[model samples]
Target: MVATQQTAGLSTSGRAVQAVALLLGFYLLAAAIVLGLLGLDLALYLGSDHLRPALFKIWALTAVVIYPVLRVVFLTRRPKGGESGGLLVGRAEQPALWARVDRLAERTGVRGPAEIRLTAEVNAAVREDTRLLGLIPGKRHLEIGVPLLIGLTEAELDAVLAHEFGHYSNQDVRLAGITVAGRTAIVHTIGTLHERADRQQAEDAAELRAEAEDRLARGKQPKDRSAGDGGVQRVLARLFTRYARLYFRVSESVGRRQEYAADRAAAEIAGRDATASALRKIPTLVAAQNFYLGAYATLGWDAGLLPAPGQVYGGFAKLLADPGRRAELAAMGLALPEREADPYDSHPPIAQRVAAIEALPADGRGTEGAGPALDVLHEPERTLAELEAVTLVPEAATKRRVDWPELVAESHLAHAREAAQPILRALTGSGLPGTVDALLDAVDRGEGRQLAERLPRSAAATAATGRAAREFLRPALRAGTARLVVLALAESGLARWELSWSAAPALVLPEGMAETFDAALDAVVADTPDTAPLRSLLVAAGLAPVAG
Candidate 1:
């Protein structure tokens, strides 16, 4: 029995490692493909017969020269150098921080002192080598950016450090540091390229718009209008737009995955809840820091818009004072807080991260915390069996059917009309009597589906709307199917839509229909022979199946 148990444990550990390795492999493969494509595009563009090789060479050379010059200008124009050494563990003058770090190191059984570092941003990282002059193995270093240390409470700070030490103790810190360095380098390269492309795009757009306007002014038919003297401008605009989109999309994807990996590592080191709390806190600190920096820059005190020293610390203090603001911010995103620059985002949305973490079992065991973190983590086969036993029923037939009038009344189409009322009233008040009313009435009663059918059907519109419905609306509706059924009946003339488990004639009652909609959906789908496929479809749509 002991030997069997040991073998089972080894097998589970091996699987966990395989899972993480697979994910990392996929990421590297994607990065390589993207880089390859980019290289190919550059070669083709530069070598094209239509474009002179010498001219292309000169342009590339000029771009290379301009990039660093702009980078230096941007960096130099920002605030000058601040404190560069490790930020003292606690308060600037407090000795308790170091004491606490010593205690944590002793508890974790990791060698080396924690080398702290201060930065405006809220972050803590474990560096393997602290001595700037030489490489040192087994000499681990910890840097807690001042902002993060100041933001977290003593316990929270300890939790953060423990999490870092978890990496060190597990011998994962070196690997993580290497990954970070590689990602940073890639992101920086992409960022530089994106910036240059954006600048070029702005210039190209202005030139194209001017040329198009000029052609229009000359009374040339729209189709007859040439690109004018800005052929190069038009090409550059197209190229830049394509590059900008590709760069951001790829960067955001990679960034989100890296964040997940890091979060998982942190959770393994610290308790899940503690890690969650730290993730929640950093956003508010960052926001506060940003606000202060903006204010400082506006007042001409700071050199640029970046956060000032101690700004995050001040922000944390404000949150401590205003509990309401703190709660609001905490609730903003459970995993990853939203930021203004989402295009260049290097992390997943907070809500997604929270969901992922919540999915983990309570315990911190398992390789990279990928398996059930709960005590007695279930075998994969057992887990599958359990899931199969908890069969779900579709909502459509289980609940009462909605009538056409009620559906129309409760739909977003009606909401849009209601929203447009004020604008129409304002237009009428401004002396456009009777003009806005006709438009408003026409819009309010417009049947999107009917209009779609009547219009000269474009294959493109059909494909696009189908894709949108499948990709976006279907999932959204499934997510809130129960609430949607209730809401639909409540807001409509319908009255009877309740969920039911048994087979029954689902009626579209004028009242109380909301209570029956779930039952109606289940009955409709359950009667079908291919219940398994039907249930899968409903699940994909985001609906919960009936208990029966």
Candidate 2:
């Protein structure tokens, strides 16, 4: 790690600034230590004093007891876990990937990381796990975004990997890890303070409510204060807020410098052209991944019991292959916030990164002999299945993978079921006829806006009725028939609504809406003395009356 060694033996000015930052961190630590000691001394002195002094000593003892506890809590609180944004791939699972990473690390003059992880994010990085406020270095891991792997050729992927490895080469791995720990500590402390403030506020509100109830019982007025932070919590919260802002400002400034240096190291290894393209493609691919995920959520959710990564990727690739969508996504990527310099941002804007890469000496290299980067994985299908198993909806775990056309049909069927449930529930009671009459009268009175607002907003029913009201209700209301109105609602989107030969209504809730309706129905049936009466009433009405 020649670059890391060079950074270590930095010039006097660089060394001075680094030393100042380190000293400031040490100063905070020393001040906490001094406060603890002072409180300890005061506690010891007050223990031997009279009652008046002992009362004051109690406050000192409180400080002495709480400081160490808070300090330890701040030091030991787990960082919000890393993004489980993708699946993990061990050496045994992806030998070729690991081998390539080894070659890149050796070329980049950085030690091989402890592990490599794959994610669905559009970025790659080398991160060292830090614990105990950075007193201990846990394992270092390399995380590569799967979308980036899919988008980039082998040469481009190599350049991105080299860029991450560059951080390790310059010992930014360790420096960044420690600073990240400090940032986490600051955030955790602030959160804890706010949480305490929240609890106090809640208790105060409850007490005030109780007092108001008592006053009302006695025929008296109640007084309440505006909600806000109170007592010592307010001061501590404000202090931490200011400190967090300052800490991030200073840290991100240094962090940006590290990014630039790492960029330079990456260029030195993988060539400027490759690095520049890789950086530019990152945001674009990120936008594409978002679109891809939306597609999965909509059309691919219930495909089959075993959807593989390749199938998922294939679906996404088809999405990207659309000329119209590709252009829209490319525009979105360009629109992402980055052009303006944000003082707290760790990486500079993409334009600035590109400029920096351009300023470097050009190496006459091309992306020759490059292939698809994802080919390095051993069993992509199985890997994809495993990843989906953990991340997909529970029902999806048992679904069998289906082709794209089948997926689309399933999605439509699911949506139809969701849309119809609330309508059927509303129809169940005797009051449904009266409700329908009022709705028709409202439509005749041109009170569509008011009627729309008053419609049941249960997820499936709301969407269904909304569509029907907008597109079909006017015609049905003009016909002045309950059956026609119901028919129009079904046609427009309320879902298939009809009567069975048994002369009772048969309704299917939209695929996902049944659970929601079931929960609501549970509450109604729970306290009823005889659900049988309700069931008979529903049967007599030809549709069960249930509150939406």
Candidate 3:
């Protein structure tokens, strides 16, 4: 990407300073809003008489407005830096990864994380348990994603790690906790206030409904009245919500600048080209891993089957190795991803980040040649298995595990069987035996159109009737019949699903049968149906009596 001046006029270090100031300002303003409301209410209560209803009402309303804020301030929850999610990898378990972390920490001029954890996300992160609003820095923790370890080159991995460590070097990690804590508390308080308002509104509606019912029963006209409920809570929520938005904008603006500083540090630690390359590949790698998981790894999830441990996590490597899939991913990697402009976007666009690195001179302490980042772990397979165990959902972990080949066959067979079920049900509803042979008999007897009409069709298929309906139903019928054929062939040991690493599972048949499999099924379900080729196929496979 060509470097631009408009978006990045300030130096990285200068932006870091400005972000620190904004963060401080955000906190100060938050404190002022809460204190200002409370102070005003206190003055009115202490200085003014309590006997006046209007004056007392004014004070009470002010108190209600400040109530949520007061709770946020005094009853704030302390930040536990590393609590939820991620499996903690002890130094003893993976000395190689820890050694690299320690080396990078020294280079970045910051102490390494006290604990390292592995997570299922696509990015790396650092967090500090800063005490007393970042004044006292406590335990530091680092989280590295499994995908990053498996997908990136060693230097690319280092660049990512360096960027996270940059937050520590820039002194932003300590204070980021406070900014995050403030946002969490503000958002929580607003949500609590809204819940209270909703409950009160529901109660008021129920009370009105009861009154109307009573009036209707007594032969009297129902009267209209205002609910006039939850007004205080609503007002309080609105006030806090505005403050929360401001806090988000200011803090996140700081967050964006901090990201640039971190990226700069990454570039200095790793080469400019390496840093830029890592930035480009991370998004694409994330996309590929997600696609692999949804399309391949969980194919048999409905049938309680999973890729054996390590395979679930390591299957992504197979995708990148495929020439066709690699080209697609490379194209995806070249373009920086775009999305709806959000105020809380904490990182600069990848294009801009890469361009910034491009502008820098080649002056980095980059290490040796490229290798898989997974090399950093001792016994990578064992570590990956452990990662899979921790990352997979509890139910997924309990699923029956199988090798990739068997997993593909079993999963696809399960899907085929499931798809055929609807057709069976449709046949039974029409006073038929609902067997494959019964379906063949009905089609042969010219009941195909009637049966097609009875089968479930999409709204688009709604317009089609008579001959048109049969045409629309052609694909569904053929698919159902194909499933039946595959089931029979498998039962008789004539066909099987062969694993294809680059594509979907292949339904392979015997030498002569493989070539005619599709043509046979098509001939069997054509508009003017012919079951001879299909019946011949069954006979050859030794499953006799195609139509019973």
Candidate 4:
């Protein structure tokens, strides 16, 4: 009877694991096949019959090697065997919080005790060790991060903890960790390969340019160069770019799906309502985590630990503020309470997950449908308003003004100094600042058009100065309704001009607005004859004009 029961339990667990594994495996395989075909096409175009074959072989080998390595890495990384030394735990001043965790564990019948830890960001996870490697034979331990502990209410916290314990009850944590780790490792490897390819291409281009210069100096015509070189370069660049994009997409999809499986496991082990509440709280947590990560990066703590804060904030804020981004976020089901399994995404989109939870039957037992609605964790109105208040402005409109001739001279000097050190060593074996400066000046004049066209984007630090200027001029502009008064700033090299009211308040001009503004500015500038005269008159009258 004992042997029969053990066999039946094993069969049940295998079936559950197989069902999820097959679905996710099929999705990943299809993506890999598509990427392989594209990579093959690229290789063939570059005239690398041997290289193409080798690339495919390596790709296949990585897929095999990466999968197992990722599994092992993830499984081993978690806080297991009561390893709480590295984590910040037991630092909470609230005695009630510890009492709550103990009570919940008892109510859920968890064999392992849950340890609470704190982090600056808002996130919580139930970490455990199941001794899959057999060193401790079924010994289990649970750990909870502080961010989630402090962020959620008592009931919400309980629900989250229960959902984590659900992983233990369902025995899904072991497999979940492996899958998450494997996917991360594979994506990281692909990114590294793409970067290496880019570096190689850059080196090749530099070498080609040097060779071409030598040939030209020796009186060889451009037509004397070998055919197909341009085509080969273009093909190589295109192939690498395509491969990089596709690889990232595949990795993102895998990550999305993995999240869904974890969520499903949580719902099965705890309750549907608890899972739904946890999902709802994620966006706020993500925002807070991003803020802290940005703070660290700005202080130059570690570049590898976070994305550039400005870029991350700008991108996310744009997504949140724009109507289109709002719609997209909504479509992802950010406000919903159901879950839908997506084969393409590793995690089901938030909307789908919410739906899945809502669909569960109210019988208080696992069934084919979602459960009853839990209390919604609505964000404070003030918080939502604050997010809405953040804005993005055009870069060109807010750049600082500089004298074009002086700026060009400085750039020339810098470039000449850079080139002089190498040339001096190769020739006279001594660096001359005067000679370097002269050379740089000549190069700058020659490359003036190119530099002008690639003008720097507006600096965020300069926006405040620009805004002060706009505020000073606002009353004057509003005085006359005959024509819309727009302020124009000259480009660094005087190649072109851009207009703005203030960076934040983008002045939307009607059709033919530029022509009208140009005519007006031309008349004013023509009368004044110099930008300094006009700027002085405006500033003397309390208007602050910012120029680049």
TM-scores, all models, native as reference:
0.37, 0.69, 0.83, 0.42
lDDT, candidate 3, equals: 0.78
Error of 3 at 144 (Å): 1.1
lDDT against the true structure, each candidate: 0.45, 0.61, 0.78, 0.42
lDDT of 2 by residue, 102-217 (tens): 99999988778888777656788888776644435668888887677677777788889988888776667666655675676667766776777778788877888888899989
lDDT of 1: 0.45
lDDT of 4 by residue, 1-548 (tens): 99987875685356445544543553455356556655765666576645656667756754554433333222224323345422333424335555655665666656545455433234455554544321122544555433344334444555566666655544445544444443444444344444545665677677767788887899985434332333322433344345435544554454454455446655655567656766676665465446433432122222112222232222233324446534544454355554555444545667776666767765364332232111121222222222223322234223332332332333333333443333333222222222322222322344212221222223532253554643433232222211212211111221122211111212233334444444443333232222233333334433344321
What is the number of backbone collisions in each predicted candidate, taken in the order shown? Answer: 41, 14, 0, 34
Model 4: CA > 4 A from native: 1-87, 91-95, 113-115, 128-151, 221-275, 284-334, 337-344, 361-548
Clashing residue pairs for model 3: none
Residue 166 deviation, candidate 3, in Å? 1.5
Question: Model 3 over residues 186-265: C-alpha lDDT tens digits?
Answer: 67767777888888888898898899899999998888875755767776678777877777776777777788899999
Q: Which candidate is the best by lDDT?
A: 3
Better of 1 and 2 by TM-score: 2
| Residue 360, model 3, lDDT | 91
Better-scoring candidate (TM-score), 2 or 3? 3
Q: Which ten residues in a row have the lowest lDDT in candidate 2?
A: 522-531
Q: Which lDDT value does model 2 have at 254?
A: 76
